[model samples]
Target: MRTLTRPAARRHIERVFDATVLDVLNSVDLVDLRVVVLQGGEQGGPPAIAIICESLGQIDLGWIETGDAPVAWRAAAYRALDQSLGRVLPIYGYQYLFDEIAMYYWDGETEDDAARQSLIAYHGADADELENMALPSEMNARRPAWMIAANAAASKRLPTALRRKLDTLDRASKALGGLESERNAWNCDFEIIQDYIPGYEECSSLPPLTLVPFEQFARELDDIARNGMEMGFMDIAGLCPLPDADRIDDWFTALRRGVQLLVAAQDLIRLDPTQL
Candidate 1:
């Protein structure tokens, strides 16, 4: 992980960004990559899609791998997953539409700044130059798993028709924060989150996890679904498109089957907190 002294980090952000207090970006880097094939159904389909899932305390986000799959298919992130963030902000990038771009971050230059700052990040097309730079991709995993667990465990949002068995749910209940694992899971999850997105709670924009019974601190995911926000805070990567000569028409939310499950939940589940 590349780091900058406090002053250096400030200069770097000002150099690349428009220097708007409205949207402050902190750091950017190309972290890792993966390879998988496609399997399109209707709304979403990509048989081969590489996906990475991560969790911190209560914040759970994912990364998607875009770009051509390697011939060997078994590349490593140099075991980048095994290391800690060292309190550094990790920004990333992607192709917005036709152009390629990298992602950047913000919030927490110091412990205090990190505690209570809110900044919007981006993917590709630099704020100053608006140039397309190549992002890095390092793939070295033996076999990446398809992981798309919901970030929300509260609201009783589980679907009536999705068919996740009770025993099955019971097993993954800690991450889901359900059954006996309710508040117990929430406390455990929150501490784990500090490691990944340290000082996230101090940001008022983010939802708080009160010890007041069972709650899900997934307001970021809600923002993404509601506001059409691009990948920044709680991010996703690696999308596949079926392109055409006239204009690209066939597009899928390429988490492969994992996304398919969410889409199914969306269709089958109603917006009722009592559903769970």
Candidate 2:
């Protein structure tokens, strides 16, 4: 890892943590469901819970909550999501979407006077010189993953080797998915073949684990999904230097490690919480 100051490193870790949790929520089709359900009826539930399961069909939600295939999928999803986010986010200048929002609107910075003063401080120029600069509202929007990646690529923060690896993995994963779909269609028209093929084993979905590692991943995801809004964004720009190539490399290493662990765990009958 890059030798960042303690607070800066912590900020990066927290961002990774939040993104990983969100990734898990999305993977299990639970992005729209509440992580923790309180005493209130569903209709009168907390705002966080209200939006939970909004993206899921009733059937999908039921499977995740009660079925073996889905629960195991959830565990694997957690690992994949965590790995992907940890590797990807650092590439994009070590900044997150929330960081953009915080710059323009959060923490009582809504007023023109406050914002002007802040901008003046940032640019270290007089108000007169900064008058024609774009307002934060005009410039700000949530940065999508692709946009972040593009920014990193533009700045040369994403190394060539890492880029090629990411691209290769993405294309291979898509090809496997396509193969599965084609096979399913063929099975519909003909007979099922018990033949060996790379990734064919993945075609047979595993049951969810009843293990502690799975539970821990699920629980952490639940907490973040439910209470992430309560956690404010960091002022990374003020506190930390823009991430350089070395920092980006650190994130890439972390992400690869996460993916490797996830691949190993998915095929296992047992998972230790300690490993997670």
Candidate 3:
């Protein structure tokens, strides 16, 4: 697959993030609360979102009792932003260097640690003091391989017993043309097994084993499975798109390494669950 250029990647990032924000805002219970989008950073950068508390200090926290209240709205905004950042950023190839979210308050007048820390703590940074706050650190060039392994392991839906049933078929599909008979048998077995996997759509269509080679079909299936699995894992992991251009490939390399580690880990786990 072709990688996206930086500009196209940023556009994709903005579009997905905008959708995420809209969904979050629509769910808010307040009537007057609005989310404001402003151009962030220097020329040619993605927009930053702010939860506009129109009346600010005058807001009747009591009347606005739902999750859209000043406190909750800000919380929700950060949540949406963080979740979007975590999931979308990586697709274009980027990873957050740090865990803390950034904020620019009072019309972007000041950007001191006190302000950052207060904002972070107010919105749920678990730190006792500004010194302990972790909001404004630099982004790392690469993500740890373990994170990708975690993503893969997290995406697995089949139990060990169920997955084991495909061993013969999977092995046959890997070998030479001797697997024609094995593929046909696997197709039949998959028809029955796929049904037992409640809500699993992956194995729904068993392209007649005679029409297309099992190896070809397997590649197609793998693409579909990887997309679904990664999306699910990213959502749960709270990763976002990497805005920085320089380190995108580094992040991708880390992700590949993570996938490799995950496959190895799975093998080990299968060999001896107790030892692992």
C-alpha lDDT values of all predictions: 0.25, 0.31, 0.30
- Poorly placed runs, candidate 1 (over 4 Å): 1-110, 113-259, 265-271
Q: Report the C-alpha lDDT of model 3 over 1-276, residue by residue, as the tens digit.
A: 979999999899779856755554453232223433444333444333222222211112121122222333223222222222211111211121111122222122134555565655565554455445333332121322222223222113434532342343233223322323221211123222223222334422211111111222343334333444443311111111234544334333333332332232233223332221
TM-score of each: 0.18, 0.20, 0.19
What digit string (tens of lDDT, one per residue) describes model 1 on residues 1-276?
A: 998999999788556533331121111112222222234534443232222222212212221122222211101110111111111112211111101111122222222222123221333234353222212221111113211112222323334322243223222322222222211211223333333344534433221211110122133223322322222233222223233322111112112222322222223222222332
Lowest-scoring 10 consecutive residues by lDDT in candidate 1? Answer: 93-102
Which structure among the candidates has the greatest lDDT? 2
Let me know the TM-score candidate 3 reaches against the reference structure.
0.19
Of candidates 3 and 1, the better by lDDT: 3
lDDT of 2 by residue, 1-276 (tens): 559999998789668855754564343321222222123322432111111112311112122223344233333333233334222111112123223333533333545566677767765757687667544453333322222222233313334433344444444333323432222111111111112112323321211111112221333223322322343211010001112324433333333333333333222223322233
lDDT of 1: 0.25
**lDDT, candidate 3, at 150:** 30
141: Cα error in model 1, Å: 38
